[model samples]
Target chain A: MNRRPTLWLLLSFALVLLLAFACQQFTGAEYFIDSSSCNGCGECIRICPNDAIYYNQSGKAEIDQTKCTHCANCVAICPNNAVY
Target chain B: MLACALQAQNAFTLRSDAQMVIAQSHTGVAGLNRMSWEHHFGPDLDLSVSSTLNSNDRIIPTNVQKLWHNGLVDINYRGTDFTVHADYRNTVFGASQLLGLYPTWDPLTSQKRLMQHQGTIAAEFDADFLQLGGFASGKILRYTPYTLDLDTFELVRQDNANATDVYTGAVIKVPIIKGLATHVAMDYKSGTFADNGEYDLNKLNAGLNADYKILGNASVSASFDWTKRTGAAISNGKTNLLRSTLRLRHRFSNSLAGYLLYINNSCLNDRMKNLRLMANYLRAQVQYSFPSDPTGGSYLLVGGKYSPENKADAYFVEGDYKVREKIYAGGSLNLQPDWQALISARLSYYYTPVNELHLQYSHRQYTPWNNSSLDFGANYLGVGTSFHW
Candidate 1:
């Protein structure tokens, strides 16, 4: 019987995990790439060992973290300017 | 990536909404998956492939090589008044240990390759809250090895066949109450398997789920799946499996969430062999969007899992950070206590069109009950891309 009560406690616990995904849907810290700030510095591309940093036709570098290895190479490489 | 960097020029219409990834494991397993393909040919075609590169003493001789492949295709259409889709995938892999090169273990002898193919196809339609689909899948396998024993190439396995499965299912979604929705689905399957050494099983499954949005950030739901499989070699004679899961989500604040989940599974066969074999896992994780003043979002997760069959229970803690929308990282540390403690880290690059290069490295040292230990490790590095044009 004591273990039965513990089930409610455990169920309440799992609900908490998914709340973050729902919460983000509301706070909506939307981010859009501002290609204007880019300075044509390939440093971001070079530092990203995983090749996550790339340049568009306009020579502006962008980072896609999903492909990023979080190796801090790009962060360490950008000299003039870099975001993400 | 270079193509994406070339934004202003003539470039492919890389579906920013598509998710594609290529992964490889040292065990000669490699995979490329495109969840939804927005093809240059059409907006409705999805393509994916998973393949393998095998070398070494695995199913071949010294320096001999084998290439395995997996592919997928999906066609989807959603007009203003109609919706229809079909998805198909096939996985083919080599599974064989290379026998010694020859009678004398010749180093220059030719190697052999063993392989198998598995495939599945599903077609569905969306009308109202009802969906109807049919699926067909199968596996064909072969294993043949040749040794250069003074130039004698011999056949290994005499019989290597396969199995096929065809299934049809119906799904219905209904709003039960104001804040609750119920999903019910049932599938009937016909399964067949060959190759005397392998296991063959047939089964049917039915699943139902209920989701209720209680308040804004909190909801509770329950789900169940039941499958009845024909006895097979690997089944230990088990014929049926039933699993049930209950979940509750609570978002107390922007930075914190409390989730509780419970799962119960049962397998029954001629007798109830693993009737006592049950699995229960409990975990609570934290999500933190890097402060706006900062750069990105990071999630810290810690959880516990208990499987009855394991020698004992184990505890795991993991943390992941997505700081730059361009940088991604996660690490896991686990403890089996008096038994072992291990840690692993993962780093990834983010690419638009949901495809990019990936590099991963992990190490684990196994501690024996006798206090002796062996170190095990795996590291993977590869590049993959998905393009619609």
Candidate 2:
């Protein structure tokens, strides 16, 4: 029988986190959100891990560009696609 | 941050893919380029940069190019209950360049289109069991070229409005018990419009999340959230929203599992003609996952929606399989209570040089919905890919 060593399991967790930030190299996909087309629905804000979308005094939702990781959750959730 | 340190020890991951399809006598070509660079500067500092470029061309209409860039330099300052960070970003959003090519398209010909605009910012902060941020940003919105519809007297440049909005907020998290947490956030924003108008808003939010482990492979989660928004602009508007969701999940074994979710949402949309909109939906699904395979999972989804004034019902069964490591495939059969059955599927590939190329093709029949009367029948095909780095 074969089983992974504990150290291997540790490395696996490390790799998953690496995949989170270091694996963005997939480019040229038709996957950008048009922010202007977005209605102030906050679904994407709730889906974000970074808590990046906020209100700009105009009462509309805004994304914290710095905190945004370009994950495209905003694009996927927007039925009107104001985010791309 | 740990990720940056790990990836820094490796280098040279290059990937790219392109595809072209001609269907329904319509030709389209699309491609993707994605890359990332992560580096660690010291014990407390790390940086990561990511970018994506997407462009598509429709033979007669629907041509578009969307480009985005994001980067962050995180300063990890260890704290008792929070980690502090600082990030900066620059983004350019433009869709006019593509819409400009399709002059004869009725939907866009007389409508508003996005020209070009940029959003830029830099911020620094500190935290402990709580987070707060303050940043400066500038935005520009350009009107799309438009033609007036004289008969309708509708002056539409698509949506000719642009503005720069500035705001900041903070989040506070509190744990009530094991596997339970509560959070509260507040935000304030100001917007300046190009049409000689402005808006200001203040909002308050609170939410709670809880999870219970029923067994080794089963769990239940529930959440409730409420928000209050008051806007002082064009017309004074005040609204409130309450949303909640509950889900139960279980895995029968290493290859099968299921879940059921219930959602309730209520809102007062001042723009909904003063009618409070309430929507409720229930979704349930069961799946058989293919073991020893990272790409195959089959599921049956049944769900329905109910609004204050109408109802909708649907059911679907779908299967996901990785015919090849680089190739992924899935499809579904859907049935509506008042419409024809819908069928859909796709085959997609994840390409690599030393590995086989991935490809996906899917066709789906869509059913339309009407609160007054349900009538439906539509179909579409989508083929796309994601390259690795």
Candidate 3:
């Protein structure tokens, strides 16, 4: 029974769900912080473990879109690389 | 007064890292090494050390040699809110048993040399609505003593395993209304397996969470968890699990934001052999920044998963830029479905203000199941430095 390798694994799982639905219908993914090289030096607000950074009002360092989980550990622990 | 004397000054930091890795597959080329050191003594102690090295260029085990070496250490402490940590690790690896496609080139899994050691201790305490923690860990493994020139299997007697683990957890936060909050937690686990005493293990878990704050940039969270596990070598003889999670976040401005996540899991086992397992997962993401340059940024993620005969989907997009002020650049692209496609790139340079230098690259393609299609590539050149006082 060679159903063509199960029809090529169901056409590669329907082309990975049609390219993940065309990448969520054209883009969207969150994580940001770059107040001009953030000098708010909160060190990503103490490594924000979901306290999702803070210090806006031009103090720079904001990042609390519902408590970031974009896990990048504050963009690799921003050392003035300013979270990205 | 200079921000209160710089918030009661007391800062010190030191960091150092080195990396060199080159990997290529078509059955050849391999070299990897990493080094690290970190220290901080302000805001409560800190220390770290790391090392890893691997090489044994693959290609039909010419005179056997499949390398690995690893070491790690970390220590941390924080007072005035309590926190403590300690960790140690050691590994001397090379244990394979064919898990497929270049499963490090099987042959009954490259002959022995697997020694591992681990140690851990943790503690936590926070009071702003109560929080607590506890942890303990231990591990030891050995598996050297094997010989079989030119590899081709055959060389047994690799047994040595030890274990000891303990955990205790706590959490409590309440504050409903005006940006809501409610969280509860409990956890316990114990493990023992000094030479496999029936693989002893135990676990208990409990959870409840809720966080709300819709409007003013939105926020939502939900959680539920329950777990119970027992030993007897744990293989569907005693297990129970239930998990649920939901999350949603929004912030349509300040350069945009968005997120959504969902998870579900269920498991049951033993009742005279009645095992079951279920799973579900969903993810969504959004992030953007570039509004007149926020040092540039980007994010895009998509996810899906369901089980009971598998179902999966994935997507990815990432970006970063700072090309001004100490050079920085990033990129990422990933996809899934038998895993095919993965591209990565990075560039860094900070050379002052705490040193840095970096370069990275990645390329991957997959389709395993004896369906021919495997491409892998990696390259990393690194240099790092840091010092603050």
Top of the candidates by TM-score: 2
Tens-digit lDDT track of model 1 for B20-70: 211122354333333322343355433332222222222211112333333
* Candidate 1, TM-score of its B chain: 0.58
Per-residue error (Å), model 1, residue B222: 0.6
lDDT of 2 by residue, B1-389 (tens): 11122345323223334556444445556555545555556555555555544444531222222332222222334344444444433333334232331221233343233432333343333343444443444444344546557788664454454435555566566765555667887766555532332245666888876666666798767666666766643122226554565677898887778777655544434452332324444556676766756334333333332221222335657665666545556666655443235566666444542223334443322234322122122234344433333
Which pairs clash in the backbone of model 3? A28-B286, A29-B285, A29-B286, A29-B287, A30-B286, A30-B287
**Tens digit of per-residue lDDT, candidate 3, span B213-313:** 55668776665555666665344623655455666789888777877765545445645333243434565667676564443432333332222122234
TM-score against native, each model: 0.52, 0.55, 0.24
DockQ for candidate 2: 0.03
Each candidate's fnat: 0.00, 0.00, 0.00
Ranked candidates (TM-score, high to low): 2, 1, 3
Q: For candidate 3, lDDT tens digit of each residue in A1-84?
A: 235433433443343333333322211234555354467545454344333454432235665432344445454335333333
Q: Provide the interface RMSD of candidate 2 in angstroms, 1 decimal place.
A: 17.3
* C-alpha RMSD by candidate, in order: 15.4, 13.0, 26.0
Best candidate, lDDT = 3
